[model samples]
Target: MRLDKFLKVSRLIKRRTLAKEVADQGRITINGTVAKASSILKEGDELAIQFGTKVVTVKVESLKETAKKEEANNLYSVVKEERVTAE
Candidate 1:
């Protein structure tokens, strides 16, 4: 599935458009490499997202075209979450 779609369907981002913007700005990476909004994602892929002062990392567990609130968390597993301190 597309990175932007996965982000929204998984509830990682509030909306697909926001996710696309974030990806386009280079704030997201897949498997340690920067990814675009249209990046292809597969199960077991790792995603690192830079969100303002914090960075969130998650591993893709599954892909769903649509997920309910309770099912969203099943799409990915949170690997790490850290706050970035500006130098």
Candidate 2:
């Protein structure tokens, strides 16, 4: 699955375009390395998304082309979420 697609399908981001924009701006990483919007995702891969001042980390659990709102959370497991304080 593509990073942007997964983010949208999983409901992490509201839309795929926004996810791509975020990835293009280098606001996302896969397994500790910065990833692009087209980055490939697989089961067990970890994703760290920088949203404003917070960094949300999640592990890919499942991939679905389309999922209902209630099934979105099943696509990934949130490992951690931290707020980065500006210095």
Model 1 scores a TM of 0.97
TM-scores for all candidates?
Answer: 0.97, 0.97
Clashes of each: 0, 0
What does candidate 1's lDDT look like per residue over 1-87, in tens digits? 999999999999999999999999999999999999999999999999999999999999999999999999999999999999998
lDDT string, candidate 2, 1-87, tens digits = 899999999999999999999999999999999999999999999999999999999999999999999999999999999999988
- Which candidate gets the maximum lDDT versus the true structure? 1
Global lDDT of each candidate: 0.98, 0.96
Write down the RMSD of candidate 2 (Cα, Å): 0.6
Tell me the spans in candidate 1 whose CA falls farther than 4 Å from its real position: none
